[model samples]
Target: MDFVDLEPEIPDSIQVSRDIVYKETDQRSLKLDIYKDEFLVEPAPVIIFIHGGSWTTGGKEDYLIYCLAYAQKGYVTASLSYRFSQEAIFPAAVEDIICGIRWIKAHASEYGIDSSKVALVGGSAGGHLAMLAAYTADESYFASGCDENAVSTAVQAIVNIYGPSDLTTDFAVAQGATPKFMGATYDVNPDIYKVASPITYITPDDPPTLTLHGTIDKIVPITQSDFLDKALITNDVIHEYHRLKGWSHTMDASVPVNEYAQKVMTRFFNEWLNGDD
Candidate 1:
């Protein structure tokens, strides 16, 4: 396939809204950006993008290109901000993501969004949070501080890009990033690491998932996705995995890799979120 431009201008057909607060914490306010077609006659499926920064950096703007591109394809798109690991640890980012989903569902009508067809897409640390939020939708542990308790955080689909899945793995344990984010050494609090792992909660009833990982990704290690794929297979979850060759972490930043990912994601989303149940 030909290389795609990473800096395309958003067309006028899509409407953009920036910095809308989704949740409030004593420390700061969490916000998100929404993009959608201005004249949709029916509710469109939603895709919420989370950014990657090893849980301590990046922001909602990190996925601007994806948001705009998907909005042009008729899906309501959003990118959200969450508490970084520097400010809060473990479930804090996951909680913020759940709250963002709830906020999107709560305002679904205004944005012409189909609340039942929501999808979570994230890269690296964001991907980890996306899977955690989607997998634990029925669990109440992470729902404690969320405002819209009645609204479900459940998603119909998920797209994880080079995200770490098993935090208890030896690679994760060896990585200082994991320890910093969890606020404890793996030995000191193995239980918390297990709980924070997305693969820990897989089941047959979980949403359809799509995973993309670079084979040579050293930052998060491709084995993370390998373990996730194995878990999903064991649970009989509907899923697809793309192991890109000769690529490293954040390969999507490369124009060709991003193009390939967009095409795969478009097909995956169409099959899972837009297709008949």
Candidate 2:
């Protein structure tokens, strides 16, 4: 990931801490940008956001505005960064995400975040990482040098935006993105692909999920979310699926659709993360 080329204008009412190092290894250091309403009381619910750039591009800077929007809504939100495919392969991004959550928990008191009420929000490739990270919320997956037992990486809920839930599916294998991230095609690394897929970890005890997908997404088909929705139902895991008809992969093309999706996401996060539900 690279530095955010531009930053969003932050309102005075929101408190922000940019580029805080979450993990530092011999190779590189991972950072995150945090936003929270200054007036928010202690034990505030937190949201960790992951950006989408096909798992190869994008960084915390890309999602500043999105994070701030959630902060303004009274949640402590962090825009997190992870290793790209060029730097490392599968499970590396996953480990970084888990580390980010643990870092947040380790410093929960200073940040005034309610560690137990955290939520994961990501779009595109970030969405995939968010789902996989939340599902693999165990100590064994912690990154090297990070304390696995410092705090649970488990999230109370997840908001996945057009992420591929199953990499073994025809659409995912044909898309080439999953293969690139996994370091090989499914035929050669079926086990890795299965371990990387979030759909494979769905269980009755999994956190509630909210998925939004554009019907005409060329990169990641809406069927990905459809399959996840079905699995969630089969496991009796509470969830909501929003299918944006006539829309494509990126939400920028349709203003109304983007705004509506944001509204839905905001409501879902507020209800689940803020303990309103």
Candidate 3:
């Protein structure tokens, strides 16, 4: 059997996916795959995991394992895809994500997902968007031709896995990353790069965040998490930072999170999402 041909025939207790409650572009309607233990009973908190590939190279299906992992832990997990850089830039991907959240809120009762207790989890580029969805409370960021209030774009907790928080760095290493996805900075697109960086929007009202990073990450530096950690701390926002010593950017894959890291992450979500889990 080929991996691509393999369909996860999840049990009836779990729901696989459903329709587009809302959309960004008519041609590019967003989708959501719901995995829940039940649909008729108590509503559960939903975890939306956005995958990372430098904002230009990945899709929702790439995160199937992550979606299942969280669903098994008793949450309605939806892995989502957004418009990539080449197709559309900054706010398009973010708008699609906001639409997905609004869909959950609009169909909250039917899907058995709590609209209030949502968490956005992402790695790298996805992490950047997750943080934006959590903190950018502005109403004008997205196109309002459709239902204006549909996208809440707010999250209760944040998990940034090696996400880049800074776009302007004196260090020659990370300065090039923003250009690859954002085009030329010195060109007429300065505002584009500004919004892509999450560090620009940190505020006191932002939700609590948990960041995991590695010391040797070549793609995104450890200092990226450090800056976010310091800002969150300075602003009195609740945050927890974990540094995977001797690990690289893909530490979650290359290095063991160890017993301690797992305990901390699990506990953070458990306590934050579940009142007493």
Per-residue lDDT of candidate 2, residues 1-277 (tens digit): 1223236688899988988999875558899888888888867888899999999998887777677777887788898889888888877888888888889989988887888899998889999999998877763643535654557788899999898899888778876567778899888878877778899888898988999898999888888999999999999999999998877786632557656866888788777886332
Pairs that collide in candidate 1 are none
Best model per TM-score: 1
lDDT, residue 213, candidate 1? 97
Clashes of 2: 0
Residue clash pairs of candidate 2: none
Comparison by TM-score, 2 against 3, better one: 2
Query: Which regions in candidate 3 have their CA more than 4 angstroms from the true location?
Result: 1-13, 18-27, 144-151, 170-177, 186-188, 258-262, 275-277
Q: What is the C-alpha lDDT of each candidate?
A: 0.90, 0.82, 0.71
In model 3, the number of clashes is 0
CA RMSD of each candidate after superposition: 2.1, 3.6, 3.9
lDDT of 3 by residue, 130-168 (tens): 887677754565553435365465778888888888766
Best by lDDT: 1
Enumerate clash totals for all models, in the order shown.
0, 0, 0
Model 1: ten consecutive residues of lowest lDDT: 1-10
Sorting all predicted structures by lDDT, with the top scorer first, yields: 1, 2, 3
Candidate 2, residue 258: the lDDT equals: 55
Candidate 1, residue 216: the lDDT equals 97
List the candidates ranked by TM-score, beginning with the highest: 1, 2, 3
lDDT of 1 at 66: 94
